[model samples]
Target: MTGERGRGRVQAVAGVVLLAWVVLFAAFVEVGNPLVLLATAVSGGLVCACAVAGGVVTMRLTDAETAARLRHVFVVLEGTAMAIFYLFYGFAFSVEPVGRPGDFAVVVLLVLSVPALGALTLVLWRSYAVHKIVVDAFGPLVPDSGAGVPVQRIRVLGTVLVTVGLALAVSAMTVALVTPMYRPVLLTVGLFVTLSPVVLGVSLTRVTDVYSARRRNVGNYVIVLAASGFAVSEFASGAGVAGVLFGALVFGAVVLLVIAILVVREFTGEWDRPWREPRGRKVSP
Candidate 1:
């Protein structure tokens, strides 16, 4: 009993620490903070190791065998994937910190667009799923897996994001209505950021197992837009409009980060399996 309790504690701590990993990576890519990515990856690895060991030792039921195997893979993959993703973004910057948000935005725009231009590009690349980009570029470094995400989990996560987004939208709108402290451009940015998650959540509804790829693809794009993951120091350092924009950006990033975490855990758990199958059909391996 004591051993089991200890293992549960370890797993809980590991989960909390994993959130820090997502925040760092999101900030790293968004703001080009190299230090945040490195620190979180290294520390996340140590905690994940403890979590994996505890899980393997304590899994007692026969039906939980598959879960034990999956949990083990996901924990290790989470740590390793952190390092790979950090390095992937590292290629985007020089030794110097980014001087302007515009430049960073332009670079991201290009990266996101590259996967879509021309025929050959489309053939070599299948879907624009963010994981596909990482795996394709890194070359077999991370295996492409189904993630085997269930319908309910996806909907639940999306619902939570929508709820938070609406809350932020209301608060920001209230502040804007009360006073005209912010520039029109800044207010527009905040308003759009607030709505992005709500839109993304709705998109998830169209993805019921064997939905159209185009519909699901659009959902993925919305997820990326919600966070607009760029460096936030300049926008985040203000008291009025700046503060509102900063809060919106942080909320968006959290939404994106959490979704990524859920998908990756499922992706790494089930290797070489069909992602979503049509009803009344069995997918061939």
Candidate 2:
């Protein structure tokens, strides 16, 4: 399918999903005992709907100028959603009288917000405005028809920082899960996890279109790193520190392999061409 058509389908699906979530939250509100769960679900659904709506609006812009304006608006909407999640659940997770069910819902919502906001920002900015800006401003920095060496170096630095942060956070979470005395440490770890994505999001937006090939490579790396962190946290919680370390090592290895593959692809002329055909009007990129 064409990119525009695919985007339309995705927006439609997002709308349908948001509607279903609204209905589900409404039903739970009427029948559930824990008010916190109902409130959290309802708020989360509204935020998601807002994000989806922003995406739809962004997709409607056909020109680069209009798209840039819409992208700015979308970013503001995303920031608002992030603010709401941080203020509500980030603060309430410890003090709220919510039961385990409500607490689970809160945690899930917080996690979902990161990717939902990330995807929204990506779709909007990566379309044209941000892409053109990076391409025009840093075109000389990018390698000819390949992943730029400078961009790759920056990505490497980002990967290292993200890896270290994830490691420390996961280690803290594991200890908290295994020992009741470390619960405060776990809370701090959760805060770190929440903040890391926010920082990554801002950084990514600033460098969204630095190099098309490197963008995909960097995104893939981030995903692997995040998955690894989750695996380590879960394994540690379920088994022991040995299990967590082993899982983390495995994940780290997989990410390293992915990085190697990306680097090889860059050098082997595999990523020398545009991944997608340019469409509409060229905007000086």
lDDT of each: 0.42, 0.43
lDDT, residue 117, candidate 2: 48
Model 1 RMSD in Å is 12.7
TM for candidate 2 is 0.37
lDDT score for residue 39 of model 1: 41
For candidate 1, give the lDDT of residue 68: 38
* TM per prediction: 0.41, 0.37
How well is each residue in 1-285 modelled by candidate 1, as lDDT tens digits? 344445445554554454344444435465444543344344333334433434443333132333333344433444343322322232232112356532344444243223212211221111122233233344322233212355555666567667877877776666545544443533565567676667766655444442332234433443333233332223333345545455455455444544544453343322223444447753321
